[model samples]
Target chain A: MKYKDFNHWELAEDAYFVNWVLRPNKHADKFWKQFLADHPEKSEDVLLAREIVTNIRYSDKPRLNDTEYNDLFERIISTKRSKRPSNVFYVREAQYRWVRYVAAVTLVLASAILYNQYWLSSHPSDEKTIQTLVKESPRGSKLTAVLSDGSKVKLNAGSKITYPKEFSDTLRLIYLTGEAFFEVESDPARPFRVKSDKVNAEVLGTSFNVRAYPDDRKISVAVAEGKVKVTNADQSTVRFEHTLLPFQESEINVQSNQVVKRELQDDMIFAWTNWKLVFKEEPLSLILKKLERWYGVEFELKGAIKTSETYSGSFDNDPLKVVLEVLTSQDAFDYEIQGRKILITSKY
Target chain B: MKVFSESSITSNGELKKTTSSRKLSHQEIVQGLEQGDESVLGYIYHRYVQDMFGFGSQFTRDRELVKDSIHEVFASLIARRQSLEKIRSIKSYLFAAVYHRIIYDIKKNTTFKNKNQKNNYREFNIEFSVQNRLIMEESNREKLNKIKSAIKNIGARQRQAILHYYYDGFVHEEIAMIMGLKNAHSVTKLISRGLKAIRESIAVVVVLFMTDLG
Candidate 1:
């Protein structure tokens, strides 16, 4: 009979037969062993299913580990840096505000040209460009630059940059990973785009910095001037953009695609540019994310304690001991920071 | 299956010793794990890791993934060990948990579950090993290929249920839970129907084989 002729009961019966004979549990093995004795003709089918199931069970593709895990941890934990600080061009909105607008306009034009030449070569005129960027920087190396039109960017170590060579007239686009400080140029006719691995940050004429790493689910953008929009790529049809008024910071969680915007010390947004740890009621995950970047080590958390409890405090280049002490000070928590891994628990 | 073959399982003789030194009972093991006792965790790993790893090998021959999945199972057990009362049997619990985790990880990385059934079957086509390879005296390789093709013609869901439950010895409830069934009854029905289909199809081919022999 055709499979379609089988009623739900019949279908379920065949399903069970295939599953039972193919994957043989104690129950199925006993049942089928008895079954073949009564209906000897059914033996071939049972054997076929068993062989097929055996084959399928053994067929699986392998998963590879992230080779850069140690390097990522090192960058998060260590503070030692190069003495030859090559004129690090840190761009704030105040110093070169006009450069932001120029960059924004150029981003728009570059995107338009790239879209026409690549994406819209055969399509009708109403074409939109979907730009993607994937950039990664090595450890101890930081990238500082002003785009052709004037948007300033300061890239942190172990970061990635992928974007269209230029922005389309309608939309300006760029992509980032790791961390970067952005001074976006403003243009009402176009919206500048910085699509991180998990998020898309957009703005007109504003000065902000975004720290978004692919491996880490948290994407942080702090606005120092004008307004900004940070959208979750995993969610939203038209991009979730946060209009960042000055002195405000927003973190977008990639896993849940949840956004949290908070007001903080405006100076802290630019503080990391000068080597600092700024914590304002941050979760252990956020602190650990930053700590792992500053120190090259891994953290292994075990036990019954929930790691989401918020810790409120700030430190500027303080000793690593103080950081661990502050984390362990909570009555509900205790921690041990070993050479390369920190183990946090509720036993304290 | 590859990892926990009879050879490796038998080779780890010390692991099989029925020591009378008041070894930790299941409850004690759960308690120690909940209390964050590394010794208890290590004991469980030593006792169960090979079996689980071997069982996982049947699912995929990727050694690293099997190792990764085995570690995840232990880690999850530690995290949930506090509520051990809910687990009826640690044996079934660990097996089902590892199976689900492996499937989820595979689905996420490959995104192959939703594609056409033919591609799915192709992805799972088994390559015979050098030493253990079946050598049919009279039947040629083409006949073996036909048998494989016939097996692939089965439904994907039926095939998965059969493979996980029959080959790995996973119970109906466990299979139901992993396959996202509502209850054991559903799994029972699914296995039954899948088997009947295979049985009927294979019977026809067997008859044809007899006729050809005559």
Candidate 2:
């Protein structure tokens, strides 16, 4: 019979007959007896159908035994595990993880060759300290860029730094635009200076952080080890100076050239280096900027609402959509996304 | 027909060429594999390697081609073991892997220069009758052989669905996945259609083979 002669319900009946009735279920027995009573002349066709059903059901097909199946799976998994990288490839932890891996590996390899070249030419390994000079993170980004000097720099969002290919014999100089963390190689002979738009921080063989985003009015420098000189560089002469000790930060107001000192919490300032974004009553507009930078996307809003809303929340490095979705899940907020733009409105 | 003792009816294990390895119980093997044990892998290889090799060999008469393809599946399992999720049922996965490897091998070899390579590949299948001839005799043997020859004349996909469902013993879900159908229901329809086609082919083969005697 043609397939079209049967409807979907009939097809279902055919399935029910083939699978259930032959096996002798209560329903199947009732259906089979009723089927015969209803159409006695077609009993042979039904019996043939039953036989076909049983044949289809009971046919001995080949398959892998348990022991063999397990062994195959085990071997495949073990090999894959062996190939996994040891370090958590946290893309946002240091820089974009995979890119940073390739970039770091390439940079290390390239630098290693260059270091070897330098060593062969100079014939001294210990004389020169190699460091990676990294630029500061942008306004809403936390990133690490290797400096040419082998001094590692971790840039917080809304930060930038510029350093020389090689530090001069007399001085190590770097220009900064925003926030950054620096691990400087010990060289008391050559003092290292980071020049921001308003604040200048000088250090020798120490780790410290500087925040001097151009858009922000404050230039803050926090010292973790040793000491640093925070000075107002915009003045014709050094108008203000603060000698900052460990666990101390100096904030310089760019507009007024005024300076303030505050005792530091190491975890709070260094948190960005560890892939955390901390906020204390931060403006909603500022948080949006950070989200956009973190996810490498752009956000647009109506001008009037951008400056009016303020938010307080902390986040780790996560996908922008995931972060936004989580944020929207909170009470008193409703938001919708159209393509890349997130339209935020308060629920209350 | 060839005669064989009980000893010759060995479990599905490796063969040199020209024969298929026997099918084994798939359920237990799959359960063992999901438990993170390597022993199961070896057992599966031993059990299915011959049958998989036999099925693979039908695509090409060359013994090395079948062996190489079978070996590749094992090697791939080893290399990608970590990535593979612990499977609850391995029958679908194993057959799918073997079938894919066969297709890959066919594509890689430049010698099989032909138009509609996919159609050619689909047309090549290890049918039931030819396979049963080695183990059966008399009227039963004739039925099996006639069925196999009849299967060759059917449309490629229909033949595949029929042979897989009837001979290889794949379920609708497995067959659908292998044939790239959207769901099991589609597979059921396809299979019923295929069986009807096979039945027609069986009628034609019976009439043709029987008429020759007259």
> In DockQ terms, which candidate is top?
1
Runs of candidate 2 exceeding 4 Å displacement:
A1-143, A157-159, A236-238, A302-311, A346-348, B1-214
Question: What DockQ would you assign to candidate 1?
Answer: 0.08
lDDT of 2 by residue, A218-296 (tens): 5566665446777765444337778876567776555555567887653455545545555545666676665765554
Q: Residue-wise lDDT of candidate 2 within B157-182, one digit each (tens)? A: 66566555654556677878766779
Q: How high is the CA lDDT of each candidate model? A: 0.52, 0.52
Q: lDDT by residue for model 1 over A1-348, one digit each (tens)? A: 253233323433455665665455898778757866876665554554344445444334333222112211121112111111223233221222232221110010101112223334322343554343344555445667665445557666555555554556776666555667665554556666766434556766544566655566455666654556655543342245566655566765544546677875535445555444566666767667667766545677777775566655555445666767766664466778787777777783
Residue-level lDDT for A102 in candidate 2? 7
Interface RMSD of each: 19.8, 24.4
The interface root mean square deviation of candidate 2 comes to 24.4
Q: What is the lDDT of residue B199 in candidate 1?
A: 52
Q: Candidate 1: misplaced stretches above 4 Å?
A: A1-97, A100-135, A138-150, A164-172, A184-191, A197-199, A215-222, A229-243, A248-270, A302-306, A318-322, A325-339, A344-348, B1-214
